[model samples]
Target: MHLAFVAFLVAGISDAVDGFLAKRFGWQTELGAYLDPIADKALLVSIYVALGYYEYLPAWLVIAVVTRDILIVGAIMLSGMINRPVQMHPLPVSKVNTAGQIILAALVLFDQSFGLNLVKLTTITVWVVGLLTVTSACAYLLTWFRHMSAYEADVHSSLKQQKDGSQIKPRHFGQNPRA
Candidate 1:
């Protein structure tokens, strides 16, 4: 457990370091974009599973966390496979959700290490994490739905324009075609 806590701390620190380097040095790459999230998710999921197995956390919460990540990864894969890759920006609620999960995990590990008996804090954190997880999932789903709807509308509009012999084309500003 202690080793796990240490590893978690190291992972958190490394994430900050990598992010700083990416922004400061303009070292962002296509691979980093995908790898960073995958690494984070892998670490988080592993920690959650370990914690649950040891009875530090609830199994249902563990399932929820793992399920959410699976759903997200699955959606991203499906989108890419269909050649309609969606740009995923972390929503504010999702950021809060990540923070809540990190805090909860840290607190649980700390309590276990020192026998702090922080039941009240643990209870509050668990609820926050659970609620945020569900909300973040909903937010992502809603965004995906809206994006698909807009894309469909655009396709329909273009098809209609084509069939009506009114194909829209870009024109330069202050330029008239008949001039």
Candidate 2:
């Protein structure tokens, strides 16, 4: 348990430190953009699954977290398959959800390592994490749906214009045709 806590602390702190260093020195790269989230999710998901197995965290919460990640990945894959690739920009709610998950994981580990009975606090944080997880998933799904709809509409309009022998420009989501 102590080792687990230390490993978690190192992983959490190193992420922040690395981000600071990257920005401070302008070391950002495309590879980092892809790997950073993968690392974060890998750590969080693994920890959650481990804790859930030990009955330290609820299994359902772990399932929800994992499920949300799977859905996001599936959406990305589907978008690519249809030739409309997704460019994800993290939402504020998603950031909050990540924070909540990290905090809750730390709290749970700390409570176990030191034998601190933080049941009430743990319960509350867990629920908050769960709520944020679901809400953020919904937000991402809604955004993806809207983007797909807009893309389809633009394609249909362009095709119709071409068939009608008229020059018409189709606008994408958040784009102005007049501009």
Candidate 3:
């Protein structure tokens, strides 16, 4: 447990340092933008699952966290399949939720490692994490639905225009229409 706590601490610190360096040095890349969130999600999900499996955290909380992540990823993939790829961005609520999750996990690990009784704190954290998780999921879903709806509307409008013979035709460069 002590080793695990230390490892988690190191991971968190490293993530912070990586972000700082990226921003401070203007070294950000498109791939880094994608990988950073994926790495954070992977770490959080893995820790939550392990804690839940060992009965350290409530099963419901673990399920909620995992399910939200799965839904978001699934939605992104679905959007791509439908020719509307959603760009990944951390919504404000999602950032809060992630912070709460990280804190809760670290608190649990710290309490376990040091054999400290932090049940009250842990209980409060559990509720915060749960609430934030649900709120974030709803926000993301709502945004995705709106984006898809708008895309569909645009497609419908274009089709209608084409059917009415009012759509603009593309002209080739250096070609004379009189020819």
Candidate 4:
């Protein structure tokens, strides 16, 4: 259990390493798009579970983290429902929240070595970060809604204009054969 918790921390650190290397070498790829968040989620959720199981951290902390993930999952499902895909772009607040989580989790594990309670400091900070996490989730939702709304409006406007005898038909993709 202890080793697993530390493993999660190391994996979280890898996220930063990958980000730096990607930006430094222009090695960003579609796989990183999926891998980065997945790694973060695994690290976070594993720590949450370990802490809660051992009662090192309050159960509510884990609940809060899970709730944020639920929000993200809901957003993905909503995007799918609307037929508009969403790209995972971590907002600044989200990145901060993630960093806070990684720090708090690592601190919790370190506290075990010293047999001292670090939850007092980590708990307060976690609450602050949790609030930011929720805020970021709401921001993502708003952005997704606006994007899908604009797409629907554009489709409707094009259809309406076509119905009203507008001679400007929409062009097909990459087919500008000058007739």
Clashes of each: 0, 0, 0, 0
lDDT per residue (tens digit) for residues 1-179 in model 2: 99999999998899999999999999999899889998899999999999999999999999999999898879877877977666656777889999999999999999999999999999999999999999989988877787777767767877876776654333232232233
Cα deviation of 59 in candidate 4 (Å)?
2.0
* lDDT tens digits, residue span 20-119, model 4: 9998999989897688777678768877878888887778778878787787767766766755455566667677778777777777787775667676
TM-score each candidate: 0.85, 0.88, 0.87, 0.76
Question: In model 2, how many backbone clashes occur?
Answer: 0
**In candidate 2, residue 106 scores what lDDT?**
96
Error of 3 at 46 (Å): 0.1
Which pairs of residues collide in model 3?
none
Q: Tell me each candidate's RMSD, in Å, in order.
A: 7.5, 4.0, 9.1, 7.4
Over 47-72, each residue of candidate 3 has an lDDT whose tens digit, in order, gives 99999999999999999999999988
Best by lDDT: 3
The candidate, 1 or 2, that scores higher on lDDT is 2
- Across residues 29-114, which tens digit of lDDT does each residue of candidate 1 receive? 98998889788878888988999999889998999898888877777666668654566567788888988999999999888887
